[model samples]
Structure formats: structure tokens, C-alpha cells
Target: MSRLLDMKEFGEAAPFLRKSDLEILAAQTVAFDDKPTKNIVGAWILITDPLCAGKKRAWIPDEKDAYIEVEIREIDGDKVIVETKDGKTYSGLFCVTVNPYKWLPVYTAPVVAAYKGKRRSEAPPHIYSIADNAYNDMLRNRENQSMLITGESGAGKTVNTKRVIQYFAIVAALGEASSKKGGPATKTGGTLEDQIIEANPAMEAFGNAKTLRNDNSSRFPLKQNQSERRRGKRLLPSRQCHSYTREALMIIQWNIRAFNTVKNWPWMKLFFKIKPLLRSAATEKELAALKEEFLKLKEALEKSEAKRKELEEKQVSLIQEKNDLSLQLQAAATEKTCRLYEDQMNESKAKVEELQRQLSDTNTQRARAQAESAELGRKLEERESLVSQLQRTKNSLSQNIEELKKQLDEETKAAMMAEELKKEQDTSAHLERMKKNMEQTIKDLQMRLDEAEQIALKGGKKQIQKLESRVRDLENELESEQKKSNEFQKGVRKYERRIKELTYQTEEDRKNMARLQELIDKLQAKVKTYKRQAEEAEEQANTNLTKYKKIQHELDDAEERADIAESQVNKLRTRTRDPGSKASPKACS
Candidate 1:
């Protein structure tokens, strides 16, 4: 649970396990948790055994046959322990998947790491080696076992599968080397196996490629086996894997069998030479041996025109001989010189002439019959010759038609084969280009990831440095604030000292005000004494004024008259108001 929790915390790490980072541990060292008291982490087991199958190409290990299992255990607070079914345990940081059985080489990790250097071939051991070993065991013991492999499409399933099969074939073919002994086994040996191996490179170059799931997938079609009826008209059972081809030995065997059958047929046919026909069998001793056999056919044809001509000449000679005999008989009768003899000669001539007439008529009738027969024979022979010529012409035309059809068939087959080969080549080339492109893409992604990691490291360092600087500045500012707080305390002490001094000065000013008020009252009493003396002097002057009043009355009357006169004079000067300012100026002048 702790491992699972840790993985959950680090989520991205779980899903992006590269092939280079993943490792398959050995079966023996793996341990499983069996105690009920201990916590279970996970189960580990071996899922495949490449060496079990008789055919190396058959890569799937049979589950019912064999497997290795392991279980992981957690102990104490920080320790992880692995315990196996065999009662073995270990303490370490461990990685456990569902499968633990298959023992892959430890060098796989380093080899995978070298992919950046463009070297991928060395990572894991080829399955072919295991297959070869397994195949050897089977052959040595005369045993056979079926192999099965199951995996998702792109996980090197087909490639591993092919390697297993190839291993088995190579191992099984080893005995074929002995066939070089010039015995029957020599025909079955290395030459045949070498050809098969050669064919594989060509097929792989054509059929394998990069699909969405697999970097190198094969595109071969499933071969189907079919049963065909041959000319023997018998059921010949045979076995073929899909797309199987017949071996060269099988073809040679078929031809030999066909040759033997043709020699044992029903007819006894002859093939004598044509030159022996020209020589006469009677004169040539060697030819005489065949005389009786061929002479009868020659005689039948010889009795034709030549024999008829010879028979006509022989009939003429016989007629001329009979006339000569008749003339002699007539001369003998005349030599007798008697009258009866003369009468007999005359009778003989008449009989001869009558016989001649009958002979002539017979000859004419025979000639006419022969001419009719010859004409009929000629017509029959002409018809037969025409029929024979027509048959020969028909045979020649049929042979030419068959030959033309065969040539046309061959040309058509060649064209079709050429088209098929071109298509296969094009498909193979396209797949190769795709594989190259995919590999390039994978390399680019790896480089980008490395660049991102570098950028993140630099940013993290800068952030740490900034935080450190901020902390130092805050420390300095705190010291300055403490110093300002001490200065404020000193200023409060000075203000308290000044406040006490002002209180004393205020009390002294109140006392001085009371003294000034007393001085002002004494000055007011002195000024009242001087004012009483001046009142006495004013009483004496009032008596004098009463006596002087009588005299002043007379004088006042005189002064009144003087005042009136002055008033009159002033009126006379102001007598006329000027009508115009210019007239007033003339009067003043």
C-alpha cells in the first residue's frame, strides 16, 4: 500500500516507463509475502519461457506446463521485504510486476540506454538462441512440442515469434550437413536449408514495418492450403502450411514416374527408315528379309496401267499366228486338182470369214466395257485423294492454334507476375520509410524532455537565491526599526523636563500682579489735596467780578454801538450781488 501510495503521489512516473527503464528480474531471487501478520505489497510472476517449445518460432510458453511466482511484503516502518514461495526473503527497494519468471539479461538496461548512440541491436538476447537449444533437445530425443505466444500487437510479439521459429529450423537442419557424403542424405542437406535461410532476408526486407503499435511489424498474408486433383486419377494425400511450395526433389520424382508409364502402353508401333523402300528386295539380301512383309502391298498397286498395256500386245500376236495357219490349209487342198477338193476350199473360206466377223464384234464389245470401268476408277481415286488432303490440312491448322494459345498463356502469366512483384516492392519501401520517420520522432521527443529538465533546474536555483536575498534585507530593516524606537524614548524624557520648568514660571507671574495694584491706590490720595486749595482762590475772585460788572455795563453799551457800525460797513461792501463774474471783477478793481 505504501508503494502504491507513493506511486499515486508521483502519478506521472507510473505511466511513462520507457522500455529502457523497465527491467525483468531473475526468478530465483524473487520473494513473496506468505505470513498472515505481514502486509502484502503485490504479486510477481514469470509469464513466459522461450526455451520450452520444440519449435523456436513458437514463442508462447504453455501455462499448464511451467511458471515461476513471487510476492512482495512490507515490514517495520521504512523497510520493504520480498518473500518467495520457496521460503526466501530479502530487504531492499524492489520493483514487482505481475510477472517474475522470465530471466532477461542484466545487460539489457545498459544496451537500451545506448539507444541515443543509434545502437539498439544489443539490448536483449535474441529469442532465437533459446529456440535453437530447445530444438536441439527435441531432435536428439526425437521429440516434438507445440509452442504458443500471446501479446498485444506492438510489443515485439511477431519479431520474437519469428526468432523462435528460425532457431528451431536452424538446429533441426544441422544433420543435413552429412548429406554431402554423396549418399541419399546428401540430397537432403545444407544446400536446401541454406536456400530457405536466404529467402528469409528477402521476405523480412519486404514484409516488416512500423505500424501504430509496433516499430517493426510484418505484413505477410496467411497462407491457405488447398487440395488439388492430379492426372493419376487417385487420391494423393499431402500436407501444406499456408503458402507452402513443393521442393525440387518432388518435381524430379514426378517426371521420372511419368516417363516409365509411357513406355508400357498397349500398341507395338514401328519406326522404320524411309531409305530402304527404294531398293529391290530380290537383289538386296538385307532387303529380302522384309520382302514378304511389304511385297503384297506393292504388287496390288503395280497391276494397274502397266499390266493392261502388256495384255493388249499379247492378244494381237495370237491373232496374226492363227491367220498364217489358215492360209497353209487352203494351199494343200488346191494341190489335189479334183472337183470335190475345189468345192471344199471354197466352203473353208466362207467359214473362216464368218468366224472373223464374230471375233471382230466380240473385240469391239470388250473394248467398250473396259473404257467404262477405267473412267469409274479414275473418279473414285480422285475423290479419295481430295479427302486425304483435306484431313492433313485440318491437322496442321489445329496444331498451329494450340501452339498460339500456349504462347499467349505464357505471356499473360508473365505480365501478371511482374505486376504483383512491383506492388510488393512498393509496399515494402513505404513501410521502411515510415519506420525511419517514427524512430526519428522518438529521438526528438527525448531531446526535448532533456531541455525542459535543464530549464526547470535553472529556474529553481534563481528562486532560491531571490528568497535568500529577501530574508537578509528584512533582517537589516528590523534592526533599523529597533534603533528608531530607542530614539523616540529619549525624546519623551526631554519633553517631561521642559513641562516642569514652565509650571514654576507661571506661579511667579501671579505674585508680581498683586504688588502693582497697591502702588496705584497711594497715587490717587495725593492728587485730591491739591484740588481743595484751588477752590479757595476761586471764591475771592467772584467778589471782584460783582463790582466790575456795573462799570462793564456802560462799556458794553459803547461796544454794542461800535459793533453795529462795523456791521453796517460790512453790509455796504457786500451791497450788490454781481449779475456776471466779469462785472464783479470791475467793481472790486
Candidate 2:
């Protein structure tokens, strides 16, 4: 009845449209109630602007614009509706839809109510739930299956597809955690490090494209991180998940190489033929002018072929120049490598010479120490000989002193025994008899007594002096022996202490010698290891040098290839740059 929607109106409505606005009014619904009803709610209603007035038609809206189909039935004053497109249903008071966002809460309320007993709606349902279910089904029920997402550009299709992948990653990872020890994880091992090193070029190439709408549109890009914690002797695990956001792009190029780039290709059958009539109508000119264009086209064709041949020749020459450049670069690199090796060789020779000098000095020091030690041994032997002679003299003097003391003790004991025996005889009789005998004997004894008295008196003085002198001599000898003994004991103690110290020094020297030997062994091993490493390094350097030379050659070859391509391109361009080119060609004979 009113002016129908135009392109501007449709565009605006797509973004901001109310459900009630597209629906038939309550008055119209009541009028049509008795007949087969055309309820606007949940029904497709097409509106078109016809050039001719008063003619109307309805067509089904495909998944082309903002349209969805629903099924509804009335019960008293309420409408029970199922959103067939998204598989959701609702029961509510029969009223025309006004706001979709506002109505979503109303529609999903019934689903919430139905599932409330099971706590199925504990978390708020988001758009991702659909994708989550699909992901689970694919992984659990349909393993090895593929998912295809087809849609027009900028329809949130790519975003939805990414959401599906995330759903799989999250749910599967959680499941893996429940089954495995250490939970949802990522690779923190060396393999991941290697992969990261390898992925640089892939990211650069695939995720870059120029677009008018988007300055740089990336199809896929990713970032990864690994974290590690020491758990006792082992490292704890980590988790990784991919998050993706999408943007739409405009003005993309499509390749026509297989289809339309060449004539009489198999795919050419797919396109409609261009007859002479169609071609004739494209230009506005007379027959004679058209023939003149045909002749020009022939000339242009010939010129193009000549340019092609010239480009090919130039390309060959450019290749030869690039090869020559490569050889020169390789030669320079070899000279530089040889110079570096020579420097290393000189340094090694100098180090060897210095070590030899040090070895010679150490040998001279060892010889001098041996001579000094031998002199000390000779002095020690002489002192031992003197000690032995002094010990023999002291033993001889002790034996002589012992023999003299024994003889003096025996003489004193005999004199005491004779005095006791004389007192034991009969006293008076013996005295009277002895008196007569004594008187007679006295005269004879007197003479003997006088002689004995004379003898006793003379010997007493000499014997007394001799005994006194002998006592003095013995006391001096005993004092000297005691002093010598004390000296010997003191010397023994000193020598014992010295021996103990020497024993301790010997043990320490042995330990030190062992440690030194160990250190020398370790140093020798290290020297051998370093030598091997140096040799390996030298070999590796040579290999790398070879590779570098090869790369230089390749670079030269690439340059030559580039030069050749450029020359060919230039020659073709020059040939094409004539004053005029034919626009048309004559028909085949």
C-alpha cells in the first residue's frame, strides 16, 4: 500500500529492524483469521517496489539477508514458537515482536525453565555453546572428520569457524587434564624451541595481504609461550590455547591463469562464446576503418614476437654476467678464510715454543735440588759415626768402676768376722794360761807386736789417703755419667719428636703427590679434550667456509637470474612501446 523499500531502506533496515514492523497488524490478523491465515509473526513476508503499480508478489527469503524462519501455534492468548533455524523454542503471550535483543531473553527463558531441574543453565549460554557441542561431537563421535565453513564475505563466518576450533582445544585439553597427571599443558621441551625457530618464514608469508578495507589482512597468525617451574628434580608442565580474532577484507585478486589467460583451454567451454555481432557492437566505426584496424593488429603481433626473441637473448647474456660475478665473490671469501686459519696456526706455534721453554727451566731446577739433597745425606752419615764411637768409650769406663767396688766390699766383711770369733773363747783360764804364755810369749810377742805395730802405723796413713782419693775420683765419674745419661735421654726425646714430625711430613707429601698427580691427569685430559675440540672446530669452520662459498655462488646466480629477467622485461617493454599498436586482427583465411 505504501511506497516499497529501496536499496537505501533495505540497507538501513538490515542493521536496525524491528520484528513487529515487518509483521501484519492485529486488525489485519483478525480479518484473515477465518481464511488460511497469513500470520506475519515467524512468517516470510517479501516486500518489493514494482515500476508498475498495484501488482504484488511474495518470494521466500533465502539465507541471503537478515531473515530467519520460525514455526508458531496459538493457544488462548499465548503463542508457542520454535525457532526452526537455530533449534530453539519458546512459549509466551501472543504479541508482535518488537526488539530481537529484548526478545532473546524472553525466548530462551522457557529453555532455561525446562532445563532448570538439572542445573543445565548454571552458566549463561553464549554464542559459543553451539560450537562447543559441535566440537565435542566431532572429536568424540566423529574422529578424523573434517569441518567445512562456507559463507559470503563478512558474515561472521570466519569468526564462528575460529570459535569452533577454540571450543575443541579447550574441551579436549580439559579432558586430557582429567585423564593425565600434570593437567592441561604445552610443550616446554626443546622440540617446541626448534619449532619456533622454524616457523618464522611461514608466518611472514601466509599472514600478509594488502586490502583496501583492511590495511593488512591475515588469514591465520599465532603466538606461543612456554613456562617452566622446577618441581623437585623435574620441571612442571604448562598449558597453551589459541585465541583468534577476525576482520573482513575488500578488493582481493583472483587468479585467472587456468581459466581465461589462454585461448582454447578446456575451461573455456564454461564461459559464453563472444560472436562477431557481440564484438561488432562493442566498437562504433565503419567497415573500412575496421579493416585498417585489422592490418594494424597484424603489425602489432609481429612486433610482439620480435620483442619476445630479443628478451630471450638478453636473458642469456645476463645469466653469463651473474655467473662471472659469483666466481669472483667465492674467490674473495676463500682468501679471507685462509688468512684466518693462518693467524690461528701462528698463535698455536707461539704457545708451543713458550711451553718448551718452561719445561727446560723446570728440568734444570730438578737437577739442582737432587745435588743439594745428596750433600745433606753425606753430612748425616758423618754425625752417625761420631755418635757410635762416643757410646763404645762410655761402656768401657762403666765396666772398670763396677769391678773396683766389688773388691772393697769383700775385704770389709772378712775383718768383721775375725773380731767376733776371738771374743767367743773361755775367758779367765785362757787368760792366766795365756798370761804365763803371754809373759813368755809376751817377750817373744813383744818383739812380734812391735813389728806389727810398726807395720800398721805406716800402712794406716797411706791407706787412708788412698781411700779418700778413690772416693773423690768415683764421685766425679758418677756425676759425669749422670750428666751424660740425662743428655742422652733429652736427645732421644728430641729425636723422637723430630722423627714424628718427619713422619707427618712424609704423609703430607704423599697426599700432596697424589693430588698433584690427579691434577696433572685432569689437566692432561683437558688438554686432550681441548685439542680434539679445536680440531673439530677447525673442521667445522672449513665446512662452513665451503657452504658460505656455495651460498655466495648461489647469490651470484640469483643476481644473474634477476638481471636476466630484468633485461628480458626491458627489451619486451621497449618493443611494446611503439608509436601505435593494432587494436584488432583480420579473420583467419
Q: Candidate 1 — what's its lDDT?
A: 0.43
What's model 1's lDDT at 39?
Answer: 39
| Candidate 1 weakest lDDT stretch, 10 residues | 111-120
Give the Cα error of residue 431 in candidate 1, in Å: 99
> Residue 408 of model 1: what lDDT?
50
- Model 2 RMSD, rounded to 1 decimal: 35.3
Runs with alpha carbons beyond 4 Å of true place in candidate 2 = 1-476, 527-542, 565-589
Per-prediction tally of clashes: 18, 2
Instruction: Put down candidate 2 lDDT per residue, 1-589, tens digits, no spaces.
Output: 1223221322323223223333636545665333322233444322221221232222223454554543332222222222234432444222122223232332232321221212113322333333344444544576433334434444444454444433333343334443355432332224433333333222222232112112212322221122233322221121111111111111111233434455566555434464545667556566768899999999999999999999999999999998998877865665565555455545544544554454455445444444444444444444444444444544453454344335434533443353344333434445665577658756855764566577676676765565578569757866875696577567656656755665565566556556655655665565555556555555655655565555555556555655555555555445444322432333221
Q: Estimate each model's TM-score.
A: 0.18, 0.19
Write candidate 1's Cα lDDT for 246-306 as tens digits: 4543555688798677646544122134335545554587666578757876787688657
> Residue 362 error for model 1, in Å?
99
